[model samples]
Target: MTEPAQEPPFLQDPYAPYAAMRSACPVQSKPVDSGGRPGCLVIGYAEAREALADARLSKDTAAFFDGRGSRRRLHPAVSRSMLASDPPRHTRLRKLVTRAFTTGAVAELRPFIARVTDELLERWSPGERFDFVAGLAVPLPVIVICELLGVPESDRADVRRWSAALFSAGEPDVVDSASYSMAGYMTDLITDKRLHPGDSLLDRLIAARSGDERLSEDELVSLAVLLLVAGHETTTHFLGNAVLALLQHPDALGRLRENPDEIPAALDELLRFDPPVSTATFRFSTEALTLGGVEIPAGVPVQVALGAANRDPERFPAPDLLDLDRDATSHVAFGHGIHRCVGAPLARAEGEIALRAVLHRFPGIRLAVPPERLEWRRTRLVRGLASLPVLA
Candidate 1:
């Protein structure tokens, strides 16, 4: 008997596999979960976008697992957050927190973000070797998100640790432990907020009212955990990916350095080129449906390869090449449809400010190690450098 085909090493370099898969078929059947159960991956730009907005594809993962009689091992806080809900519930949870991340709200934060960026860069000097991922990329978002949520400065470290663990691929136990810890911590924080309210986002969330509706305790805790973890995680990786992309393309980096104002516009291309979220969160078909001419059965998980779709040749001419001038607003780096990332505004502001600050601060910065020596994180869902060693 022929041995089972070896799985593609997606964590190492998913782009090549994504290309091959998309070329074969936009929607190809594959084993998506750790259990090796068969599913499908949508790699075409059009198909992925369609699937994202397709009401037939449900984001309610917990309900899907229940239908199969398989107990979902993830914590309810994670499984029940707005990211994992559908319809009325998702609509409600999202509305409660959307005000905090509006374009105007994020714009108001530009000065504070600039100050934080300057503060983070103050530690590095010219001619010094710096691990950009650890020194700046990681800490900047952590500080910003923690402060926004009123998470005590003392708890930021643990929050980061637990958030990292929650995304640890192939470590279900660790994910469970981390999720539980995060949920517990958020619960305590919410309780504290009740006793002594402040002006932080978390405080506002606790006191938020919509007509006659109010968030339940579980909803509140779940939303808090989701915000605290996701708020920083995507921005952290986006910064690392953005920096790495600029370093690899000296010409693009030069232009950005020459005209710092263009950094904001170039952020979209950078995100499209190497998105922080390689694939969107879990989504499954609620009913049997045909997508990209492929038949998908009901309840089967479908993963939209954001990294792959962003580079689909059909959608983007010379997709592989990094062209900053290209109109890349169509990229799904922050996803598409109703479930699109709520923090896109904040993330864009953070990326723009961080990139401009870094380039201005270290005009002579260069990769300290060869591109081959750089390590990417092993998580399947997140694409980011584990450590970006550079000389300034």
Candidate 2:
């Protein structure tokens, strides 16, 4: 008898699986890793929050791999970026990058973001069907991040291809290839910026690399790749997920249409309802610890399920329902503690501008196909639609 292949748990209704896991234990043992080391998944809100900030749960993935004597190879830039470093190094890298994403810096981008939103929305014809993800959600952030990072307009297509491949969890070879290509490209970009400095963020980074507060060549290249990829990828998925949520809940959509001013304030709730990043990047346990009352052996990997924690009934009453009126500011959508996403301010600005423009221009926009028919990306870290078909 032929047996049916089962859909991946993440591709299905992930909430039910999350709830099932949470019910069993907030922190549960996961299947063994490729190196035969056991791991744990943290699903409870309190536990996840604690896990994110726990110094014992290290983010130094390169060190972890080296200690395990694993033969797997990763680009030095990819493995050594701020995203994977701990304390002293993480602090230095974060401080340098944080300068570009300050409050005033992000606010300065509002006019540019609005201009791009209007330009992108101009293509939608009345009563016409189009893939919203392709048309707006994907390109808007990509364009914005590219412009911010001084990536030439001509090279954005290749940049997007390389960035997308970096997240292909099911394909290690593709990820490695993308990492090498992106690192090489970033190295060249840094050299060009050094030769011909400009006002772009990359130029500032290059200046820092050359100045007293120095950055190694590897650090400079890695930071550029991280900013380029992280800056857009999360926002892209966030816009797609936010739009889908609004479309599914027409009442909320109508409310936003009637009161566009509320859109910005409502973004937190949208983020909490269906966060873009499903699980945070992997963190390794540096020592034996008790998380959510479960004993975690030293050196095991820990994954905090941000999506699950955001919807924890213990923290959020009526977790399943999307209530824009609710105060969702505390959601771990951007993650928590020292390693929180540095690009959140820019992402929120982009989302607010993009969402407002979409609703204003295409108030009549509706899904072209059933919600269930929409396929999600197979990546483990992010939650986003492959394509959001809509009639405008």
Candidate 3:
């Protein structure tokens, strides 16, 4: 993997590289490419979707390194989580948690979501510049997820810290420390839930049934950790990304302000315009295959750029433009296939509520600094602002 210099153009804005890759070739196989992965970078929408659903592309990282003498060790919770495992194992884990994250279950949280948005917005002082990320985006989703998982309010900060470390680029040791700490914490949390069950999703998982089977202790804890991390991280970035997109595109922002009803549809366009996840998690090829005319070999790591695919000209007309009226339901911002995000409903609800409330509360909100001064996160796996400064 190649790490770019601080403040590389690609880090600040990846669309240039994405477009260039799509124009030149749908897929590129070389270590020194924009994505910096050893195998292939799939930039086309169709290629990305196919790669996502292809059984030949494995999610099992452990299996990739089974025969190799790599000294790297992964946390059990991470290795065993559904995101990291392939079918049967992935199927079982997903079955246990899918019900709790279904549309109806998330719909019930709308009132609670509004309450949180109101509480956060009420904190902003009129005419003062504030960091949207710190003041709202970062805290809101974490608070919601913690509440759903029955985590103590006091422990939310630690959860946020660990979650941030897991996704932040640099220092494998930092990722390891965060993973281990979270795993240990989740283990204790699961044990407590087993003894004192509640209405929380974590409590339900502790007792979730699959005919004659139940989740094993490790599975239970790992699933909780997955839900906790995946639940908040993506949503947090998306909120910031969506807001930033609006600030940059005044017409789009004005359209939403005029027709508040457009927030949900507008969100889909915003996500496609600048997705929170730059790429899906690494997928290892189980066997040699051809993708977008490029040949990929078995066991090679592949990076499917979601942000790139969302903007493919073949799939989206005027792909770079943020048009809320455009058909954007097909965007793969949440990924695709059997491993598609289970928390999508909750994310959409949070995005809708948060965006509507933010716009309603501050109709004149604008970037506190010049667009050129903004800094994007350095991680390749996820795309978002380091901080979003705005005046309300």
lDDT of each: 0.89, 0.89, 0.86
Please give the range of 10 consecutive residues that has the lowest summed lDDT in model 3: 1-10
TM-score of each predicted structure versus truth: 0.96, 0.96, 0.95
lDDT tens per residue, model 2, 1-392: 22224446567569888988898899988853555577899999999999999999999988887877766566888877899999888998899989788889999999999998998888878789988899999999999999999999999999989888888866878888898999999999888888888999888888773443598888889999999999998899999999999999999999999999999899999999999999998899889999999999888989999999998999999999989899999999999999999999999999999888988889898998777677687775898887888999
lDDT of 1 by residue, 1-392 (tens): 23223333665567888898889999988786667778888999999999999999989988877667663477899987899999888997898888899999988888988998999899999999989999989999999889899999999999999999888888888888999999999999999999999999999888976763487889889999999989999899999999988999999999999999998889999999999999898799879999999999888999998999999999999898999989999999999999999999999999999988999999988999877667777675888878888998
| lDDT comparing candidate 3 with the true structure | 0.86
Clashes of each: 1, 0, 0
Clashing pairs in 1: 127-392
Candidate 2 residues lying further than 4 Å off, grouped into runs, are 1-9, 32-36, 209-212
Worst 10 residues of 1 by lDDT: 1-10
Evaluate residue 309 in candidate 1 and report its C-alpha lDDT on the 0 to 100 scale.
96
